[model samples]
Target chain A: QQQVKQSPQSLIVQKGGIPIINCAYENTAFDYFPWYQQFPGKGPALLIAIRPDVSEKKEGRFTISFNKSAKQFSLHIMDSQPGDSATYFCAAKSAGGTSYGKLTFGQGTILTVHP
Target chain B: GAGVSQSPSNKVTEKGKDVELRCDPISGHTALYWYRQSLGQGLEFLIYFQGNSAPDKSGLPSDRFSAERTGGSVSTLTIQRTQQEDSAVYLCASSFRTGGRDEQFFGPGTRLTVL
Candidate 1:
C-alpha cells in the first residue's frame, strides 16, 4: 500500500509542448503529494506540490493535478523547454505516521524536451 | 552556500569494500532524510532522522545498510560489504518540520560505483 506507480517511463516532447506524467497510489492515508525534478549529476528539487483537499495546484509552468477518489495525480508542464528536461519523480507521504513523513516515490519518468 | 552539501561527489570502490557517504543538511533543520537512486530508477527512501534519532528503518533494504546523525546536523550513510547492486547515487535532504506542510531541500548527491 506504500507504492506510488508512475507512467510513461520516458517522455519526449518538443519545445513549447506540454507533457503530462501520471501517477497512482494504493495508500489512502497520503495527504501530501510532491513532484521532484532531477538534472544530471544533481539531486532532485521540488518542482511543485499539492494537497488532497484541492484538485490542482500550479507554480510557474508546473502544475500538479490530484484526484482524491481515484488515488491518482499528474504533473503537467506548460510550454516545456529543453531546460526542463530531466528525470521527474512523483512522491506521496502521509500526515502522521511511524515512517516520519518519508516520501514514497514512483519509478520515475525520464522527460526529454527537444529543441 | 547555505544549501545542503555532500562530500566525495564521486566514488569508485571494488566489491566487498565498505563505503561511507556524508551529508550536511541545511543549518538549523531538524529533519534529515537519506535516499538512493539507481540508474533509471526512482529515488528510494533509505531512512530519515528526527533530531539524530531514526524512528523507522523499514525502508532499508538489508542489514548491510546503516545511517547515523549527530548534533542534529551532519549525517552519514554506510554501506557494508558493498555489492554491484549497492552502486547508486546517495542523496540527502533536510526539512524543517513544522507539523504542517514542509519542503525538503536536497543535496547534489554522492555517486557510488562498485566495480
Candidate 2:
C-alpha cells in the first residue's frame, strides 16, 4: 500500500507565481513531513520539512503548510523561478517506533516553471 | 564536507545479468537508506541501515534484490538475474540516526538499465 499520496503528477507554473504541491498520508504514526527537490542527474535535496507540532514552516521562499488533523501537508514556492524546475517528492516518517529512518514517499510531481 | 556519494553512476546490462550499486555516506552519519526512482516516478523505499543494527529491508521488491551495509558507512545493493522491469535509479541517503526525524543527505544515484 502507498502510505503517502501526492497529487498532480505534473505541474506547470508561470514564473513569480506560487506553485503548490500537496501530499496526504494514511498512517497516523507518521509524524514528520519533508519535501525534496530533485534535478535531472542529481540527488534530491531537502527543501523544507515540518513536524506535527507545527502548523506551518517557512524557509525563505519555500513554505510548508501542514494540517495535522487532515494528515495532509503541502509545499508552496513563492516567486517561482525557472531554476526551480525539477521533480518534487513529499515524504513521511514515523518516529519513536522500530521503523524509524525508513521514509514512506509519495509519487513524485514534476514541476515546470515557465519563464 | 562532501555529501553522500554513489559509484557506478550508470550501468547497462542485458537481462538476467547481475549488477551491484554502491553508496558512501557522509562521515559520522549513523543512519543510511536506499531508495529507487523509476522513470517519471517518485522515490521508493528499499532498505535502511543504522550503526551495528540489522537493516530494514521491507521495501525490497523481491528476493532477487538485496543490500548490505558494512562498517556503518558504505552500502551495496545487488540485483541478481535482473529483469527489464528492475531498471531504475538507485539512490542512497544517510542521516544522523535511525529515527526518521533527522534530515537525510542523499547521493546522486546509480542508474541501472537492464536491456
Candidate 3:
C-alpha cells in the first residue's frame, strides 16, 4: 500500500518533555523516510530524513529511530519547546515506479508543547 | 527570497468555479510536486514533474484536477468544478532532482477555500 499510517492524531506535552511521533509503511519498495514540520500559514519543511540502512539518525534535537524489520519508524524530539509546536508529518518514498518518488505522507500529528 | 514561492496566498471561490494556483520553484531545480492539505490532515500527493519527461499524474484525485509546468519552470494547478472537499491548502515543492533526490523545499502554501 502507498499509505503511511501515523499515530496520535494530536499530542500535548510540557516544556523539556519528549514528543514522539510514529509511522509505518507496508510497501517494501520504500527506502527513504523523511519527517516534515508545518506551522500555521506556512508550508511543510524538511526537518530530518533517514535511510533504511541506518537504524537511527540525529540532527540537532530531532532524532529518527527506524525499525526496518517491523516496517516502522519514529521521530523523537529530545527537548520539546513551545516553538516546536506544529504539525509533524512522516513520509515514505520509493526510488522507481510507485509514483516516481512522490512522497506518501502519513496523517499528520499536531503537537502542542506548553511552556 | 531565494526559496520556492507560490502565488495567490489565499483564494476563495464559489463551488463549481475553476481556480488556478501558481508556483515558482527555485532556479536549477528540476523536479516539482503538487500536494493538497485538508484541514487537520496529511498532504495528499497530486502530481509531480521531472525534467522533460511527462509528469506523473497518477496522484491526481480526479479528472477535474490538472496541472501544467511551462518551460520546465513555473507550474499551475487547476481545479474545475470545485467542491467543498477541495477546500484546502495547495502546496508546491521543488527538489534538485528525482530518484533519491535531494531535499525538497516547500513554499508558503496557497490557502484555497471553496465555498
Using TM-score as the measure, the top candidate is: 3
Provide the TM-score, chain A, model 1: 0.95
lDDT of 2 by residue, A40-65 (tens): 99999999989999999999999999
DockQ for candidate 3, please give it.
0.85
Cand. 3 Cα-lDDT: 0.93
* lDDT of every predicted structure (CA atoms): 0.89, 0.91, 0.93
Residue-wise C-alpha lDDT for candidate 1, range B20-98, written one tens digit per residue: 9999999988988899999878889888887745445778999999988878889889999999999999999989962
Q: What is the two-chain DockQ of model 2?
A: 0.82
- lDDT tens per residue, model 3, A1-115: 4479998899999999999999999888888999999999999999999999999999999999999999999999989999999999999898876745699999999999999
* Cα misplacement distance, residue B76 of candidate 3 (Å): 0.5
Off by over 4 Å in 1: B52-54
Which is the winner by TM-score between candidate 1 and candidate 3?
3
Ranking by lDDT: 3, 2, 1
What TM-score would each prediction reach against the true structure? 0.95, 0.97, 0.97
Q: Give the clashing residue pairs of candidate 2, or none.
A: A101-B100
